[model samples]
Target: MQTSPPDPDDLALFRDFVAGTRPLEQDKIAPVVKRSKQKRPAATSNSSTAEKLFFFSDEFEVFAETQGTLSYVQNGDDPHLAGRLRRGELEPQVVLDLHGMTAQQAKTELAGLLNYCEQQQLNCACVVHGKGLGILARKVPNWLIQHPNVRAFHTAPRSWGKHGALLLLLKINQSTEQQFRELTRR
Candidate 1:
């Protein structure tokens, strides 16, 4: 069915009604272009070298308690470091939690953490091994002992996981020591 055209008077009235309105200055908007994230280079070589450098031996006799509190101080260093760590005098700059990771994965992560701490000139770090099956608890101290950067370590205080974690005192360079001293003075 064909419909009749609009009345001329009605069309004229509509045009007059819209005659006062102006057109939009810009109708279309520019499209946004999303940038792709850049991928970081793999540290395979660094990790491999760290694995070789931070080797832990199962046969080595670590005298620390296995399922209980642990403590160790490197030879020729101040013995008070361990006491300070246990007393929570030194704050940990980084904390690593190894709750669900396997032994190998924990080892790799521990190595990477220590390396990172050393590179950043961090003096203290906390490693939480958890009290699961006593596997990592028994091995973490031994692994820490093998790393030369570990100056001293003690079981974390009651506030910091108690027996399930250890506070490590890393061997910082002279410049780091001066910086720490300056910071502590304030």
Candidate 2:
């Protein structure tokens, strides 16, 4: 089969960028799996009837659930997956920090981050809401519970930010799902 030649202008532009940048030694990034970009997980009408257990009083505070305590939740059917995440067996690929940002700002940024993660087919990410007065820390988990794109989240390990951050496990990418189905069909 015939093929077109590489674009000369693109090659020169790429070369210029590479020449100006320092060499990155083997970041060991994984190849991304292409996926159908679903807008969000469908919030069934049944969600309206779902129990609202995420509430806490204004005087209450947030903290990382202590070790040996269950600290993760997954809406999916995989029961043990959340436990694995909390134990740090499933590491995050990226982190989104909401330290100084206001609640509204954090929410906006998280929405964008979840969408971006979905598009990139990232399975895991972390959201750092520092343990300042605890407002952000408390609200972050509630917001994540409402986020349609998130499959699961847990309190991060001490080195990862302890109660100040959360490690998230996103749903499988649609492309990955399709690939799985195709492979099984054969």
Candidate 3:
């Protein structure tokens, strides 16, 4: 196919329309700067200090009646939180069973669960530490009291687990606080 040239009149009109425009002065693009990778500070020493501050001492004695319900509320938190937990008003989003684990294992699991709950922004969790011999039953409460994320806890309702389990209310992240507020409002 042979091409035809642009109409002379159309070309003249196009030049008139762009008569005042000037070519750009600097056409070369600026080079991108390569940033050096920053070295992250080591976490070993910092984590050890944090662990010491968040310590769960085996010698920490938790006083509770032999056959009574287990309950706790963090200082300055609403006392009614325990009542709500006991009544099953707040449902647990995660459940942990420490049936056959040793005390150290249970503590480790509990710490990991709390960390996971915070990471996932979950507000509630249940810990089923069987009533057998009451070893974990006693140690669990002591360990829970040391965790900063535990807002409140109460013995589970009969249908959930009764005296053998605990309904834990974890502190909600700021991003999810509104959802919990709306839930409580209803």
Residue-level lDDT tens digits of model 1 in 1-186: 999999999999999999989877986889999876987777689768656545677666575567666889999998888998988988898999999999888888888888899899999999999999888898889989988889999999988899889999998899888888797567
For candidate 2, give the lDDT: 0.69
lDDT of 2 by residue, 23-118 (tens): 679978898998878787876353432323223223443434333332556555467667767788777878998989987677667766776787
Q: Best to worst by TM-score, what's the order? A: 1, 3, 2
TM-score of 1: 0.74
Top TM-score model: 1
Q: After superposition, how far is residue 6 of candidate 1 from its true place, in Å?
A: 61
Scored against the true structure, residue 77 in model 1 reaches a CA lDDT of 94
Candidate 1 CA-lDDT value: 0.87
Residue 41's lDDT within candidate 2 is 81
- lDDT (C-alpha, whole model) for all candidates: 0.87, 0.69, 0.86
TM-score versus the correct structure, for each prediction: 0.74, 0.56, 0.70
Q: Once model 2 is optimally superposed onto the true structure by TM-score, how far is the C-alpha of residue 41 displaced, in angstroms? A: 27
For all candidates, the clash counts are: 0, 0, 0
